[model samples]
Target: MEDGTPSLLDDKKRTSKIARLSLLSLFNRFGFALNSIALPLFALAIGQDEAFYGVMVAAAGYVQAIALFPAGTLSDRKGRGAAILFGGIVNGACLFYLPFVTDSLMIIIVYALTGVGSGFTRTSLDSLIADHTKKGNERTKSYGITIAVATLAASTGPFLAGFIIDPVAFPLAADPLFRYAILFYIMGSFRLAAGIFGFFTERWLHDNPDITPAIVEEAEEEPDDSQELNGNSRDDLITAILFGTSQAMMGISSGMVVPFLIPWIYAAFNPDPIILGSVPAVANLTLASGTLFVGLQSERVGKIKMIFLLYLLTPLLTIGMVYIPIFLVMVGFYVIRMAVANMARPASNSLFMGEISSERRARSLALTRVMWTFPRQTGTLLTSYLLSIGIMGGIVNFGRFFFPIAFMLYPVCVIPMYLAVRRNKRIVEQRRQQRELTDSVEVP
Candidate 1:
């Protein structure tokens, strides 16, 4: 393979690279999962309310949303491995500082800073994944495998963190604060482990010049009469914009209640930490299963159809959550909902990634991510305020007014992306037929 091109790597070498990167992803995801359950509880323990928790969550997203745009461009211009290393170090440092922050404001500030590092790591890693795998089915499968591996860590981290920190459950230490501190330390260690591993990985790549992928040049391409947009016939600008828009709407819908789910469950059901922790742990496990299934089967089933069917099932399932009052029933619904809703990720990622040119992939991905995060975070902030003011009042025994609105938006938001994908599919089939005709005429 040429230095700038990634199409020629032998299968074994590519698998090795993906494996190494996925290992790094495991460490990061575990750390994040620990904090995901812990952060809301920590806020309450420090005398802050759900509103403050919302602020903390939204602050991180706001920072990440701002940083991802440039991070993507940097990944394209500078390289993926280096960006991952830099992000891991920065993220680790912030997590290490988390235990020291007792004040609500400081906690939010430090956690928000973690977002900057996450943007760098996430953008670079996603682009690198695309770079390593062949496009279409293989790429989707790789994403599924990588994501499943990471989510496995996510499933376990919450269970462990909850067990260790729950004073009523474990009583490991006299002071509850001590347990929280210990949990944060463990989270920091995981992030630093990723940083250290990434550092060595980058060093090895630096030493091996032939294996390092050259930075893809993002120079403008000459206009092609046959192509409708950019240099590629299938790379439709409208499709990209529509996909991004749909994602942003989905984010907004989720942001309204997703961040507050654990807290809501705790306050409503009064479950112990173990049970509360199980929610996310189970959800992550189910998500891993769903992503893996979608990754493997998406090509066979058709990506758009699979995405549409899965998404359609989610809103119906979510509406059931609004009516159900039993904790076990709710958990079951939630588990199924998580599996069905998130299973669309790999297929959607493949669809979006396959449509963009390699040179501009990072930027386009960053744009779509920003669109999703900014709106979601904005919605989170709004929801927090509404919850605080009792504006998002309870709709029933179990549901908040925000809950149904969030799930209902799922199918609606997916519509534009569905249309866009169908259009692109049509364009691709037409081009394939045109090429066949050209080949037949030339042969004669």
Candidate 2:
């Protein structure tokens, strides 16, 4: 494998696997989009309070945290296929039950189970994709394509909900509970489709095995990453820790935004389903477009530089998300915000995973997720409390006040990433200089 242009589409096996994985990602996210809308709204309608809705939203994080480490351990030993299949099944089953669960606790419990399943499915799907692709450009492109498929598919979900059942209809609209439940049923169907895709993708990949071609640039002087003693470089640990912290902070604020954002917009502006649906849909489509460009350019633009710029812009977008007064303007800002924040994800992931030795990749990934999980739950709780108590005055608009604080938190979170990117660059330069010195001495 000399240094030449590598094409993922050139190989039949790789092409087939990537296609299946893309489809799997597409279905998985489509359900996720629907849940974003239906689950929180349903909880709010049933409980008639923001507190319970927050708690219910938090329940998924709890289960995901609990399942995270185990799922990783399982995937490393038994392979990712079974884990993903199991997760899809569990996720589908839980969503299917959501429509039937009328009580708050039951709603929380079902969502918790779905989160647990997601822990298994999402991590494995991620690791499995990483396993299949070549390092550097291929991996970045694969991730971007996979994410684009999923994002674009998910983008349709809100639109689908908007189209199917009008937010303001006759008898069904009269009862918020019944109106949202219909959407729940529709989301469950999407989950079922996702489960089927997961199973099929797994089986399809296994039935056809192909050794992924190694790239010239990625070859190592060493035998295997697993041979290292406990794959724990201080630099890697620091990177992971900083990355995880940034993710957690972002997650907390994001947790506050995603589940409750639509409901908040509806109350504040009273937008129709078409309007409501368009917001998230456009946001995701924007993300998909940005992701494709990021993938294409990240190889040349430099991943860290791209990520740093994106992180820098995040706080401004968060501010925009909070204070934009007009309905359509807010939606426009949200799309840009989502795109800016998420477009760098694959590149950031490439940087992080490149640091960890293969042996500890799963464990490191699992550990990092813990930092994100706790913060997300806490954010939801805090936001719900603010909403419940009317801390800033208006019942529906208290989030407006909290938005500043959350947006401000973005700066704090990004500090570590800034440090990591700079530090990693310094270390790489030091390594290059040392290598040159060794080569010079040897030549003499």
Candidate 3:
């Protein structure tokens, strides 16, 4: 494990590093989840229609996506710690101001600005993990731990927000609308904590002479064609783009479901906050569980195959959501959908990381994030606007129209996931053959 290659297994000291990284992952994800859960409700509080809210949220995605590649390049050059810290502070500061802004345009602007921060943090965070851990099982475990922590934070954030943001809880409160702002503030605080934590734990290339350009140049100059296919290829890039696009499209399709689900469920039966929280809670738990499972198996299953299986399951799980009527049944479907979606996360991440050179990992991941976020934001903007127009005033009817669209588009997303896996497999096989040939010649 000490030989040049990275190891996923952690010694006692490395375990500490994983812990710190996991904490950072948790805090960062907490900030993201806090906004994701509250943003729509915040817009609703301000009398903004669905479309307006969608546009606001989607704008963030577009900005984040657009900024990702640049942010990655910067991270690769400047160091992950500094990048994350800067983004965190900026993101936190923006969150603190979110409560004060009332105008829709101003809110959109703020969201977009936050996107820049998001791009900075998100692009570098995973790469930081990759840098710390040696490639193989250790890498997989580290990523899995990160995902589990993030999912745990994401699962908890919304449930907590649901209680905090409930208007009834704030009957005598100074400004009920400000409750969402408070949540944002908490999220910001978490981001700040993550930034500080990251500052201490991240290993900067500038500080480590071993990882300097001299090493990179040597690695690049080595005429090892066998390892050529080990990294990202043009085909892998295309597949990544395709997969990213599909994920974004799915985001658009699924965007309406969350906003409408509560209302629809309430209309079908009596409104129960417990049920609302429970449904999503179950889903998130499933996702977290699946992430944990995948993380553990990341090496054994291989990253590419795991992603392919996960993508294939998405349409089936999501379509199941449309048919389930009972709240519990709906929760069941949600669980399946979430687990399947999340199971692919580690694999997808590994594939992205595996495909690119270490220097470009941040950029590649950022690009993937951009693709996923942009489409979802576009969808959110479109759907929210339509909902504001009362296109389908009823929740059930809206689900009927939207869920199917999401289901149909899911297969398209799978195409990229499949292609990436297949391309990776081809590359791996090619490399194996070349290695055998070289071994034979050397033996002679």
TM-score of each: 0.86, 0.84, 0.82
**Measured by TM-score, how close is model 1 to the native structure?**
0.86
Query: How many backbone clashes are present in model 3?
Result: 11
1-444: candidate 1 lDDT, tens digit per residue: 377355545344555666776787787778788876788887777887888989998999999988897788778888877777778788888877888877768888999988888888787777776765555566788778888899976798888778876877888688877778888888877876776776566555446445322222235453222232232624645666778899898999889877876777777787888778888899899899888899889988988889888878877887776567899998988888878988788888877787777778888888888889998999899878877776645313324555776777887777888777677767766776887899999995
Model 2, span 329-396: residue lDDT tens = 88877789779878887887666666555655666677678778888888887777777776766435
Kindly list the per-residue Cα lDDT of model 3 for residues 80-184, writing each as its tens digit: 988888888878888888888887789889877888888888878888877665445556666887888778767877676766776664454468687777888
lDDT of residue 142 for candidate 2: 79
Q: Which candidate is the best by lDDT?
A: 1
lDDT of 2 at 416: 71
Q: How many pairs of residues collide in each model?
A: 0, 0, 11
Ranked by TM-score from best down, the candidates are 1, 2, 3
Ten residues in a row with the worst lDDT in model 1?
Answer: 222-231
- Give the lowest summed-lDDT range of ten residues in model 2: 222-231
